[model samples]
Target: MSPTDTDALADDLLAYIDASPTPYHAVRETARRLEQAGYRALDERESWTLKPGERVYVTRGDTSIAAFHLGTAPVDRAGFRLVGSHTDSPNLRLKPNAQVAKNGYQQLGVEIYGGVLLHTWTDRDLSLAGRVVLLEGGKPRGHLVDFRKPLLRVPNLAIHLNRGVNTEGLKLNPQEQMVPVLGLESAGAVDLRAMLVKELSKGGVKAEAADILGYDLCLYDLQPSTRSGAHEEFLHAPRLDNLASCHSSLTALLTGPASREATSGVILFDHEEVGSRSAQGAASPFLRTLLERLTLVLSDGKPDAFHRAMAQSFLVSADMAHAVHPNYASLHEPKHQPQMGAGPVIKSNVNQSYATDGESWAYFAALCREAGVTPQHFVTRTDLGCGSTIGPITAGQLGIRTVDVGNPMLSMHSIREMACASDVAAMVAVLRRLFA
Candidate 1:
């Protein structure tokens, strides 16, 4: 790709990440892109009449999305070429009774959502964005909300209070230390619900505090994604771990040549950070059910058609990989150090943590070669445990050949993660080739 093309792709990715402050927003953003590409949205509650050469997508709980392009051939014979990623990231989620007061200051109670880098979240300009469940027209409804500006902040303890801070490292108590200050008590005891109602009204979403039954709000850094470094080669942003993969997969699906044989699809599941167990998660039957329905529809209800398709299907679970950290070089496997800007990483694990085996690895390696990209490899050190992706979970659930891969980056779960701007286009090229 040319430098201009690379910069454009990176810019679009940063915009996507910035727009998606929560899982609901991420899926909505994905849906918008897909719709612009002529992919029609399908209602799960309504009957689907799918046909070959048709492009359609469906969302579950406004958080997870599945988009696919039907092949010109029989789905059972063509099988599915699918890429998967997650919508959620490690962060702080608000509790049920999120309001709390301490030492003349008001704060929101939060619980750690995943393997978050607790210390990184301190002293950042934080805002709230998520789906709010409300009672409208005598029925429960959900609306997306974003307090776009900095509405909350978690202040760090001064160094003077802890002299051994650098040596002992920062220790945080989620229940106590992580509460983000909204304002001082002198500002008056502001009702959290009332604040939401006011914010909703500002967004033109009419709702009263009494109408808001509940919410799934979470705190996010208010920083915009940026391309840093001397050559502007580095992408500094939040939620790159999986959002980068999500954007790449979606771009490939939309831009790739229309498949004449295999069915191409991308499913961005929610709740991967906490474990893929939700209804729209990879561990659930969302993908399988969709595939089975497509087979039945395309094959005219042929017996065992879903099974036949599964036998030939392949899944590329695209989550961000760990680029060898500059400060912690010894933590990585010596022979398999994935570097930022090197290329996409083919992540592997013997214990099935990543679902990449010999067959799948060879398949993906060949795909990368076809796209003129040099694929890198990653494996956690033997003595240390490996973190997983949706690869193993989806593979086990659907019984499809799966390879786990991603663009490598530093700061896997930090509030802000860094990745190569070029790798975004590289991964897109390979994925588009796979779709082809």
Candidate 2:
């Protein structure tokens, strides 16, 4: 690809992150793109009759999606080439009955979600976004709500109050120091329900305050995803930990036209940051159910087709790789420090933290070469415990040969993260080839 094409891809990525402030929004955007690409959307509540050479997709819990392009051959013969990524990231989530009046201010009570970098959230402009389940015609409906303006802020304690902050580092109490101020304390304190009703009203969605059954909203940094550095070579955005992988997967899934020799799909899951234990998480039966249904359809209900398909399937677990941070080089495994802009990263761990074995890594590396790109590698320092991805969970659950890979990135769980523009192209290239 040309440099111009690379820049366009990076621009699309920044826009994708800006448009998706929450998991619900990310899945919505992905589904929209899939539909525009001629993929039929499937309702999980209904029976599926998918056929070979058909493109289709399905969503569960409105936060997870699986999209597929069935091959020209039967499932037992063709197998599947899959890429997986999660939709959720670390952040602060609003609690039920969230509004609180405290210390001469009206604030929202929030719970820390996932492995949040508490201090990075301090003083950043924050907004609200997530799903609000409301009663519509006596039936529950989930609405995507995003007040994409700076409506909340967690202000840091003044230097005068804590003089040793710089030397001792900023320590935050999630319960005490992380509450975001909504407004001044007055007779009419900020009502969380009223705010949601009004925000919904702007989009012509009418609902009474009492009609709202429940909500799963989170605070996101309001800064737009952008690039920096001398040559505009770096990406700085929120949710890049997994969203970048989501973008790559979606891009690759759309690159095909439903005529490949093998089955190919992308799985965007939710709740990975919080141990992936949720209904829509990788640990759940979401992907397995979809694959089984697909196999059942393509194999004409053969007795052992599902098992045969599983044996021939391959999964590339795409997540962000930890780039070698210049300031903290010692934290990385010296021999396996991946770099931004170098290429796609093949992440592996012997302890099964990342699900990449020698064979799987070699396969992914070969795919990178086939895509006209080199591959980088990542393994945590031997002394430090490794963090896991959906790779192991899905691999173990399905018994599919899985390789974990990603674009190299920095600030893994911070409010905002950074990576290289070129790596976005590199990772997508490899995934596109894998699907091809």
Candidate 3:
């Protein structure tokens, strides 16, 4: 990536991360862009009849999505060139009955979701966004909603109150300190359900408080994603841990030069931060079922077509990798410390935590060489426990060849994270080479 590609892609990524505050919103934003790129949306309830050289996409649970382009040859022969990622990130999710009053202040009770860097969230501008279920004709319908304003706060205690705060960090408890203040009790009761009804009305929907079934709301930082640093070389944004990978892979699938040799696409799953055990997660049969159905349709029900396709298929698991923090250098393996602006990193774990074996990584290494991008590598210290991605999960499920890769980033689970601007576009370049 050149200096030009660096700045422009950062601007584009800032817009993407801003629009996607929740997993549901992330899928919706990606789908909207895919539609503009000429991919036809498919509903799982409907029968699909796709042709060679056609583009199609489908959504499950409104939080996960899979989009692909059929090639000149059937998948049994050419297989599928796939990129997988997750949409969910660590944050504070609202509880079922969230409202509570304490010391004349109204606050929303929240459950700490995933592995959150709890302290980073304090004293930040926070807002809410998620999916709300409404009843219509006695049936449930989900709607995506975002309260774009900074309407919540988790204010930190004063230095005088906690005199040793600088030396001894403030202890946080999810059930107590993590709650965000909504307003003073004198402002009257802040009915969240009633507020949702008014918010839906602004969107021209005839929704009522009585029809509101339930919600999956979470708090997000209201700060916009942007490029930072003295030379504008760094990307400062929220959800960069994985959303950065999501944006790059999706762009490659959309902008990659037309490929007629094989099926090429990207699959994004939700709930990865929470073990990916749900219906819309990587552990579910959603992806396997899609591939099986496509094989049956394209191969005219030929015997063993599905097995043949699996044998030839490969998946690239894209997630953000740990960049060696300058302040905490000893925590990383000295030789394998990845740095920002060093292009994509091929992540591997000897225990199979990352699913990146010799053969799988070699394949992606060749792609990087062909794309003129030099790929970096990430392997945690031997004694340390490494985090896993969706790579091993999907690979084990389908017995497919898979490699784990990502852009180097700092602050893995904080409210705000940082990455290199050049690596963002460099990832897309290598992915394009694979599908080309």
Q: If scored against the real structure, what TM-score would every candidate get? A: 0.98, 0.98, 0.98
Best model number under lDDT: 1
Error of 1 at 112 (Å): 0.7
**Residue 283 in model 2: lDDT:** 97
Alpha-carbon local distance difference test for all models: 0.91, 0.90, 0.90
lDDT of 2 at 176: 91
**lDDT, model 3, position 333:** 92
Off by over 4 Å in 3: 1-4
* lDDT per residue as tens, model 1, 1-436: 2322778999999999999999999998999998998999998788899888999999998899999999987878878999999999999999999888888998889999999999999999999999899998888999889999998999999999988889999998888788899999998778989988988888788877889898999899999999999999999999998899999999888888855578899999999999888999988989888888888888746798899889978999999999998899999999999999989999999999999999999999999999999999999999999999999999989999999999999988999999999999999999988899
In candidate 1, position 283 carries an lDDT of 85
In candidate 2, what are the lDDT values of residues 114-166, reduced to their tens digit? 99989999999999999889999999999989998989999999999999999
